[model samples]
Target: MDRYLNHHLKISGVSQQLFADAAVTAIQQGSGGLLRRANHLARGALIAAAHEKNQIVSAEHVRIASTELI
Candidate 1:
């Protein structure tokens, strides 16, 4: 998970533990349709954080992104 986040998401400056916890929470709170939806939300969160000039994707970003999703 960490590797995918680092390599695929191109994110940095966040502790692996923090990111993992946020991801787990996002997945758990998701609609339970598919893992892909959770993953998409997570990735969108990272992008949102980046857009906000955040060095790392925090729980706040995930929460915001989750809300923006359908």
Candidate 2:
């Protein structure tokens, strides 16, 4: 969880709490919850892939994962 938070903060330049709160808002309203969950899962996969590749997580990776999931 810390890794995910740190990755998001570093890559997106947003605070962990702020990102999390926005995710919760998405869960409650926008995207009907499933998209929110899919996004979270995609983020996790991106982080894992970045870690494995020894690279900084990028928005491109997240975008591709989201597209593939959809």
Candidate 3:
């Protein structure tokens, strides 16, 4: 999960992990620990955070991520 997330994060122009611990937990639980879902959730959370002008991905961002996930 770390490797996959790192790759995606790099491609997304994120230099390092910015997900709050709770947000990480939320992404894991919310995605059922599935890599694909986790990836989508993480990406979506980044987008949500960006939309809100937040530098850190919070649990709220994770919720927004889930709602926006396809």
Candidate 4:
């Protein structure tokens, strides 16, 4: 993970559980946490991209990355 992303995420003050819930939302939305295996792959790719870019993680990135995986 990029230091920049970690810093912003810390500044955002979002809890780890909250992040988990977000993942849950993605799963419920058919983004593959529960059933769509592709979604998980996409998510991993998104994290890698964001980390490489040193950017804060956002929902848009998640959506785009997940769809891209599909």
TM-score of candidate 2 against the unseen true structure: 0.33
Backbone clashes under 3 angstroms, per model: 0, 0, 0, 0
Off by over 4 Å in 2: 1-4, 7-48
lDDT of candidate 4 over 1-70, digit per residue (tens): 2233335346779433222334435434544334345336335545755666833434444555666563
Residues 1-70, model 1: lDDT tens digits: 4454455444556544435566656545663646577678777787888799976667787778788887
Which is the leading candidate under lDDT? 3
Residue 16's lDDT within candidate 4 is 38
Poorly placed runs, candidate 4 (over 4 Å): 1-24, 32-45, 48-55
Which regions in candidate 1 have their CA more than 4 angstroms from the true location? 1-20, 31-33
Residue lDDT tens for model 3, 1-57: 556667877887979788888888898889997988998898899899999898989
RMSD of each: 4.6, 8.4, 2.1, 8.7
Better of 1 and 2 by TM-score: 1
Q: By descending TM-score, how would the candidates be arranged?
A: 3, 1, 4, 2
TM-score comparison, 2 vs 4, better candidate = 4
Best by TM-score: 3
Superposed by TM-score, candidate 4 places the C-alpha of residue 43 at a distance from the truth, in angstroms, of 3.0
TM-scores vs. true structure, each candidate = 0.57, 0.33, 0.79, 0.36
